[model samples]
Target: MRIRPTSARGGLPPAAASAESPAALSGPDGRRLPASPRRRRPDLAALAVLLILGGTAATITLMLNGSARVSAIRITRQVTAGQPLSRAGMEEVRIAGTGIDYLPWSQHASYAQRLALVTLLPGTLLTTQMTATASEGITPGKARVGLALKPGQSPAELRAGQRVQIISLPRQDPGDRTTTVLAQSALVDAVSDPGTHGPPRLVNVIVDAALSPRIAAYASNGQIVLAYLPAAH
Candidate 1:
């Protein structure tokens, strides 16, 4: 029999014996095996746990904060002041909670019977001020009167929801500066532009029912002039 070179460590060659002396390295198959078992790094394991915990905490926080969402009314179109809330012009939407006493969608029927205190633009969120049911409109004790106005009679910048004071201009004597205040504070429902020709333009204003006749009389003779109210901001 031929004798193979050996080391003091037995079976293993001098090179293998000097590199590793474990029992796993005692056979020829041991040279093909790893010196130690593979294990996951503790740092990577901790990072994975932190990621999972962070995601779970974020989910829980969102669940808690999302509960403040509420169903409220949102205006879908322009609604003039003193006009009833049209069902087609409004809709219900989910939104975050608000501190204002905003009108809820559940009270649609109640506010539908009421009138707006101010002109509401498109996409406006409904509020209590827009849903006042008292006699703050051109109904009950109010009147909607259309006035024919020439240039200089009303401000060109006048628009709906503007509060104005209607005055009857003095007679054309140059010496007569006495102007009669027909309506103290009337709400302008709508006003059309007079354009450049200085032609008569129509203006619809809401006034007390008692003042409608006088206002119409002055308007007929083109003596009606509108003064912007300082009370409106």
Candidate 2:
């Protein structure tokens, strides 16, 4: 028998043994192994932009819903105490940031024919504290009376919502010309111009009901004069 040259372990050639090694067995059909899939990194800049845009959109939506304006009631003309509130004397104005204390325009019907508690100027915002019903103007044991006074009888600065003292001047008799205070701290409800050449102006005031008879008597004789009280009092 003829002896053939072989490798020590498997009786194969060295080149053939190397080709069948474990490294070559890892690939299919003895081809090179494909490179592992590359790991992907997150784009931080793009993610930051997306987050900022989302926050901006949320803020804009909140502003549009919360900052919307509505109509409120405001006086267009002067409103005196004890006078009825009419729609003609007021207007609806669109305003922003209105609070709960403000009166809305839709509630004007309830305030119509209501008496104003104080003197309301033009452009004044109507409020619940500014108005009342006609019966609300009269207090317990008090009555409302009207006085017709000449130009010189009342002070030029006397106006609605003012406090005054009704003084009874002495007649042209032999007694002292000292004046007597008939009523003190009387609330002036309203004042009106005669709108003509020579008539006296009318002033309505609230006083004790017991004094109504005496005040009417003095007013009939034109012996009553008005004295303005200090605002602080």
For model 2, residues 40-127, the per-residue Cα lDDT tens digits are: 6579878989999999999998898667777889988787665667778888987775465778899988886676778888899888
Give the CA lDDT, 0 to 100, for residue 152 in model 1: 81
Clashing pairs in 1: none
Worst 10 contiguous positions by lDDT, candidate 1:
129-138
- Highest lDDT against the true fold, candidate: 2
Q: Which stretches of candidate 2 lie above 4 Å from their native place?
A: 1-5, 11-13, 20-65, 68-101, 104-127, 130-136, 195-197, 230-233
Write down the TM-score of every candidate. 0.49, 0.53
What tens-digit string does per-residue lDDT give for candidate 1 at 81-108?
Answer: 6555667777898888867777779987
- TM-score, prediction 2: 0.53
Residue pairs in collision within model 2: none
